[model samples]
Structure formats: structure tokens, C-alpha cells
Target: MAYPQHTTTGMTTHPDLTEMRERLERTASSSGAIAVEGLILLTGVYTAISPWAVQFSSQTNITVSNLIAGVTTALIGLGLALAPERMFRLAWAIVPLGFWLVVSPWVVTPTHGARPGIVWSNCLAGGVTALLGLIAMGLTVRVARQSPR
Candidate 1:
């Protein structure tokens, strides 16, 4: 798993040649996290627009909640993706956000009727978010364990 590197002296180097190729290994491992972060961001955007897209914008309470949650989730995903070294630990927080999304239909007041579509949409998105959050947490733990301690 040798990766190309350029030295200050205009020379090529293969740091992966070292006995402990931690940096290269870490970069390789982070691909999954990057993908998950993108999915999380997409979910957030979907959640935010779901109320209108589903024709349930009348439910102002749920709409507002979803908007707030969606924006926050997107921001967190962006933060983790852009600054994993400093923000990976924040990944765990997204789990609770997912849980909130899952239960939001019941928690937030809706306008006159119970919309099954809204419930299902949130549940589906939330379930995916929470599942990915768990996976991210596991990967973070694994990476930490693999680091020289």
C-alpha cells in the first residue's frame, strides 16, 4: 500500500515503506468515513425539505423541528468531513440527532391529521443516520486502537 509523496528537495518518497505506515493506513481507512459523511449530509438536506416535498408543510411544528434538525445534522456532517482529526469525536452526537429524527413525528405537533408518510420518511432517514453514526463510532474506536499507544 505504498503512496507517492513529494519531498521538499523535489525528490519522491514512499513513506508507506516505513515499518509503521500509520498515516497511509489511516488515510485508506477514512474513505468509509468520507462516504458516510456525505450520506449524512444528503439525509439532512432531504429531511429539511421533506415536509414541503411530502405536502405536509402545514404541520408547522414538525416542519420547524425537521428544519432545525436537518440543518444541524448537515453542519455536523460537514464538520466531521472537513476536519476529522479534530471533529471525529463529535460523530457520536449525530446518533442522538438520529434518534430525535426517529421520534420526531410523535414529539412534534402536527396540523389536524396524522401523516403516515411523514412518520415513515423521518424513520427511514433517522434509521439510516443512526446506523451510519454507529458505524462511524466503531471505525473511530478501531482507528484509535490501531494508533501507537
Candidate 2:
């Protein structure tokens, strides 16, 4: 018996991969998904500038923390918007990031003690970020289950 030899030129295509991409595209293009992505972007922007807006810029530690978190969140939002198929895999990350934002006021600035403004700002921003993350995760699940093989 002779066995067939398989050869590859690094240009192989899989039907399942194509189908999954299509499903992800459809999910990402939905009006609701678009709105969520936009909102997430806005949330990131708000979180970044919140320190100054809330008059908490005096705290160097928290200010830097928020700036970093805000930039990261914004990047995630952009990734999702630009490449949902790939970025959705990271949807779960936003939850933790949000949680960190919420607790950073206490954790990052424990020595100085968090003012009401800082606490309120972080809590609200964190809540919104976490909520949006949940929504993004749901969308990811929906896309995955759309057409199971």
C-alpha cells in the first residue's frame, strides 16, 4: 500500500475558520455592537481624563494609574472595533481592568487617602467599564455559538 504525501506552501485555508470569521464580522457589525464599541471608546477617554476633570490630579499616583488604565482601555476598545474576531478573545480582560480601576483609589493612594471625588469617579468609571466588558463578553459568546460545527 502506498501512502499519499501531503505538502504545504503555508497557504492553507480551513472552512471552519472562514465561517467563524464571517460570524464574527456579522456580530461585530451589528448596530448594537457598534454602539457598544463606541461607548467603550468613550468610557476609556473619560477614564483617562477623569483625574483632571474630577480635580484629583493632585494625587500623582492615582493620576498616573488612571492615565495608564485609560490608555489601555481605549486601546482595547480600538482593537475590538478594528478587529473584533481577534480582540473579542480579550473581552474578559476588561472586567479585571474595570475592577482594578474601582479599587485603585484605595490601593494606589492608600497613604494619601482617597477623597470623595476620587472614589466616586473611579467607582462610576469602573462600573461602566465592567458593564461594557460584560456586554462584550456576551457578544463574543453569541458569535461563538452562532454556527457551531
Candidate 3:
């Protein structure tokens, strides 16, 4: 019996398995874009649903506001995840979204003003969203700087 050679040759040689594995490892790493995108996505979802989660849906205006912001944030997160190369710059926009979420209780509250639960919920969600946006922006900037001009 003859043993087949471990190597084969072709016009396109076998891809570098080590390099491919390394790339897969990098892509699946916790710090990778997918992970961050997931965080952003969750943040948006929480923000949108906070009115119900925190039981402040009685305030129609605030509920609507949160729904809008949450949906928008989720969409942005999705865009970033799906087309990061094109949408990375939009990360900066998230900073403002975060700010809006933070202040939405005040701005979107009924003339009665904001409830404590609403205030706290918006603040927390907004802060997290803003922080995540900042992280996304920082990552984008770092990647840009590292890329060859």
C-alpha cells in the first residue's frame, strides 16, 4: 500500500489554514464588531421597551418617545453590524442618540413632568447607549488610524 503525500499543488494552493484559523478567532473574539453590535442592539431594545419594563407606559408621550428612540437605536445597531465598513461613522451619531435617550424623560414627558421611574430608566439606558456608542466610535477611529492611508 502507498501513502498519499500530505501536500498537494494546484494553481490555487490550499489556503493557509493557520491564517484562516487566526482570522476566524479574531472575528469571533469578544471584542470583535459582532459582540459590540450585539450590545448596541440590546441597549436599543431595552430602551425601546423600558416604558413597559419599568411600567411607565401610562405616559403616552414618554412611551412613544422611548419607542421611537429604541427602534432608531436598534436600527442603527443593525446597520453597524450589517455594514460596519459603511456605517461605522454613524457610531458618532449614537452619542447624540444616547443624549436624547437620557433627556427624553424631560423632553417627552407630559406637562405633568417626569415620573421618577421614567427618569431613572431613561438615564440608565441612555447612559449605556452613549457609552456603547462611544466605544464603537473609538474602535472605528482606532481602526481608521491603524489602516494605511
lDDT of 3 by residue, 104-130 (tens): 877876578998888988999999999
In order, candidate lDDTs are 0.78, 0.89, 0.80
Q: Per-residue lDDT tens digits of candidate 1, residues 11-98?
A: 2365433423454346424778789878878888887898898888887888998899888888878877777766677779889889
89: Cα error in model 1, Å: 0.5
Write down the worst ten-residue block by lDDT for model 3.
Answer: 21-30
- In model 3, the runs with Cα more than 4 Å from the true position are 1-30, 147-149
Tens-digit lDDT string for candidate 2 (1-149): 99999987452476577778888888898989888888888889999999899998989999999999998889999998888777888988888889999999999988869999999999999999999999999999998877575
Ten residues in sequence with the least summed lDDT for candidate 1: 10-19
Prediction RMSDs, each to the true structure: 10.0, 3.3, 10.5
Superposed Cα deviation of residue 82, candidate 2 (Å):
2.2
TM-score of each: 0.77, 0.89, 0.75
Q: Candidate 2 lDDT (Cα, whole model)?
A: 0.89
Alpha-carbon runs more than 4 Å astray in model 1: 1-29, 110-113, 147-149
Decoy 2 TM-score against native: 0.89
Clashes of each: 0, 0, 0
